[model samples]
Target: MKRFYIYLLAFLLPVCCLAQETVIIKRKLTNAVKERVSVLKSDNVTKQGLYQALWDSKTVLANGSYTKNVKTGIWNFYDTKNNVIQRFNYTTNTLLYEAPEDSATNCRYVVDHTVRDTDRTTKPIVIGGRFFGYINYLRLFRLPPDMRNINNEVVVPTIELLVSPGGRLAEYIVHFQAENYDRKVGFNIDYLSDEDKTFIPATINGEPIACRIFIRCFLTSGGDLDLF
Candidate 1:
């Protein structure tokens, strides 16, 4: 055990020593765009260094290698408002991660969840605003925003997914008090067809809480179910 600790320390010490201590500059790409570059942990200290890039004060790319201060490999890019525009993933000389498949059923759900463009229960109905547009139906029912907080003082929201025979689609219901910022967003997702309903259990920190759920429901044309 003592020998193991010594070996571990020896291996990590160099990494710690080579870590860059601060951000040297924050540059604006344009009136609406801002970015920062900072030196961070780097491998191959003798020949290379690594740096991190931030857009709109958000760390979009990290551990970017530089050969004698020349940028190399994959780097992240952001939009003018600091939203992630594209991710450049590089390994030697190849590209991975293909764009999502396009299908009539799939496209409908995509717009329903992520963009909340339309409600699945009601055909040709659209909902506008944040959490609107399309989303992956299989992955709907997101946890409360406060659930991410480390303090654990806030209450987490619960989600339930349901599918119906009429729509032949998936839907979700979120249950939680509004005090903790509990809000519901539904989507069409991929899942097993055999199960009509599913209740997934989750937690917020150590306290027991149901966070998100994924389910399917039925949808029929000529019905207007968009209540709001």
Candidate 2:
């Protein structure tokens, strides 16, 4: 009887340890975004549970789950105002829902302005969705040393992204204007990561086409860039 009890305890120990092996990690992302990831350590460390990205450490920007580090099931992405902007299903590779395009919100333009308004057009979008893409942009953007402190004045800056039909970033330009400052900065796209350069190319009349995306942002006195 003692040998049998010992064998049973040994058999259950590994299972109990595995059940409690879940690890939670929290980290800060660019622009005050917070990421909380739950991973499981078994044969290897894998993200196997809830994943959340919060904006400003409070508003939920993204909420989803992962299996084997791949996004699975439905994922919800929200705007800074906490409104659901997109719903995607990674398991099925489907865009379940996307908010209607509002020109007042984001700027978009086709490379060829000759396209008629009646034509069906879709704007280019970053590969990993908007929240992550915005975060990446914030992480890479660096303010010029002289422009870092605005002294409570609002400074408008425009970021232009020229995307090719192949979904590559052909050109990146930044335009800044203030009381006595007017500068245009261009970056070599080759220096950017492949993931950053890739996007879902814009389409016109069901055909892929090159386009330009303009992101309007303002620099606060605190030196933080806020997108409109």
Candidate 3:
């Protein structure tokens, strides 16, 4: 019996070691954004482990585990400051945590600018949270050549997002106002990327309702879009 037990232990040790071996892969998404994934290769070569998307190779933007290349369990999406903006349980298809409306922080970037005098129980949230919206805006927004030379002045641009009751972006409006210059640009919902069209609509009494969300941004001296 002792000899049989010794043989079984030896057989299991190699299997444990093989299962623990994880391969880490890094992918560059942009000049400052990248992704790192820790995966265990199966016979099918599908991603089967931890995944993280990062900015500046340090701040984690999103992280979760994958099962057979599908997101599982709870995933955390973060802001540039490394705050957990949203926590979602993919397996259960439920929101676990969403950062409360804080006018000092997240709200400075994305705000519910609807002109409703009534109060709402919850504000509309972008699919991945405020940071996701901010990043996408930075990626897609282009500065007009005429506004490039403005210096020592702060310019605020309002991006209006009309979210439908079904959590879809219905319309987009951009109000660019600078010194003696005011231009409003309208865009169809079809112009947005598929990912950007997703949102968690606002609610008043546990019932979803269409609302308008505004992404407010300012331009820096270097002509870069930044949060207010």
Candidate 4:
């Protein structure tokens, strides 16, 4: 047992030392437009790096990984706002999967209390953002601006959203209340993101699957947001 622990540490130490890799830099590929090299992370093993060409400072333009000095893992290309417009997964320098802008990260998801298994087909695995991440996503939800502008009166909104199979948001329905916001409230959904208008998507056998969830919001005139 002690020898096994010693061997495990020996194998892990080199990988740990490789974690503090350096970033590389280059210049002058503005294209016909004004694109420039922004940030880069290089692998010392192959002396190669991944470059993110950013026209804007806040957004990542493109990102990918390299294995054995070849581009591997998931590469994401973003637009001006840093939203991923394209995503491609590469393994051994081969394209494994690719997704266009409109269909990437747009689906919402829900939680499943049941565990399912398949014989010849495995369940879809939720990648990118994992399924349980929706809890933190919901913690970030806030009342919409129009709903919050209600003259300091109580506001209640019942929201229902659909999570598509691609782990993106499908649609949302919200019913706004006026001044009488002091109503009963309970939340049965898994998670909420972007102010109760979006959600996380679940996957079946490693693919995004669709699900529905509800959000009960109780905005009080007492200057506090009460939700369960």
Candidate 5:
């Protein structure tokens, strides 16, 4: 009887220790492309899949934390595999910022969002061009109801570019013109400092990029906003 009890104790001890050991489950990766849909499907994870996901979440930046915040403010959104998905200028409230300009002046302007399709992939990836995420305009000087304003139908110019290692934009080029309000310019209006509003960078065709926007608007000689 003593020998049998000893044997049973030895067998149960290893079993109990094995049971207490942490078992890591893993999962496999599937499609990495971002397909826009009316409704997104819930991701189904498997044990192997989870393992691959854990490995992928590791950050490339050695000094940064792998765990990201519920990042508000300006953020470049990437997938679990680290491919940039989109760019966002998030805010908790309807926060307003200055329209970028060299000088301060009131003008009529229209905001337009742009998207770009890049050909650097096996298939073209649709990264957002600058201004893809959000668009807004302001009448620094309110226009009179009867005044014909040029911003009503002006085409604004914009440039898209990538940042270089030298902290400057590389291969920077104008991407597209933004649609203007339904009006025309009567005269060559002069602009003041602080009258330009630049849009935050967006991903076009899946790659991150930046842009420069020229706000097209009509400013009366007397500093009144006019829609042309």
Candidate 6:
């Protein structure tokens, strides 16, 4: 039996209901290419198979039912493994449940969560017109003076990248105390005089939405940086 439980997401609606069961899913996913659906079968004269075939052909980002084009009912979102990573209620436009990030979260998996900002249709490409990927972005990292002093070692930290809907760099947070750099290496993104946070907007529905980009940054001792 496929059991389905509906619980209001506490973060989205704290007062909806107090008696709630929670399922924490922490996993990683990579966006897979859209699959091509087979030809419509209505012309083939099978009426019974029409609806089911259409449902199978649908490839909507937010899968749900629509009444006169207005979204309604529950929608289940899937990951690369076809697992339900997230489920939302379109009637309220509220999140019902989402999987939490696990130790296995990596670039190899399909990203069903915004913890890495993959929901956006576009990811940031390399400065020189290279494709959008973590490894490509890391190669462009050239650290400022305060990043490190060690010659060959590297410091990895959780970086919070914020950008405007118009694709301008808004602010960045570097966890100075992260990894092994307690006080030896640090720089304030807030203090930068030059505008450095330029990025590719994560767009959807033909419009840009502000999003948070979180990634592990490797600040090398030779003024080089790598991101994983």
- The candidate that achieves the highest lDDT relative to the unseen native structure: 2
> How many steric overlaps are in each model, in order?
31, 0, 0, 22, 37, 11
Least accurate stretch of 10 residues (summed lDDT) in model 1?
A: 125-134
- Model 1 misplaced regions, further than 4 Å: 1-16, 40-74, 78-85, 97-228
Question: What overall lDDT goes with each candidate model?
Answer: 0.34, 0.75, 0.71, 0.45, 0.29, 0.41
TM-score of 2: 0.76
lDDT of 5 by residue, 46-74 (tens): 11111112212352101111112222344
Worst 10 residues of 6 by lDDT: 46-55
lDDT of 2 at 154: 46
lDDT string for model 2 (1-228, tens) is: 999999999999999876646677888775567899888855436888999998788888888998887889998888878888888787997778777656567555657757787988888877445555656665556666776665435457777889999888898877787788778877666767776897778888888999988877766555655553
Candidate 3 per-residue lDDT over residues 17-97, each given as its tens digit = 867456778876445667787766444356778888888788888989988677789989988889888998879978889
- Each candidate: RMSD to true structure? 20.3, 4.1, 5.2, 17.2, 18.7, 19.9
Ranked by lDDT, the better of candidates 3 and 6 is 3
Q: In model 3, which residue pairs have backbone atoms overlapping below 3 Å?
A: none
Q: How well does each candidate superpose onto the true structure, as a TM-score? A: 0.25, 0.76, 0.67, 0.29, 0.19, 0.30
lDDT per residue for candidate 6 within 84-137, as digits (tens), equals: 556666577565765654666532221233544453355432121111123323
The reply for model 3, stretches above 4 Å from the true place, is 1-32, 37-48, 67-69, 106-120, 143-153, 187-195, 219-228
Q: Give one digit per residue, the lDDT tens place, for model 4 in 180-227.
A: 453323343435433233323445555555666554544455333333
Better of 1 and 6 by TM-score: 6
Model 4, global lDDT: 0.45
Q: Which prediction has more favorable lDDT, 3 or 5? A: 3
Looking at candidate 4, what is the lDDT of residue 88? 54
- Candidate 1 local lDDT, 21-134, one digit each (tens): 543445543222233444333432322444544433553422345555455676444322344333444335222222222242222222223323342222221111001111
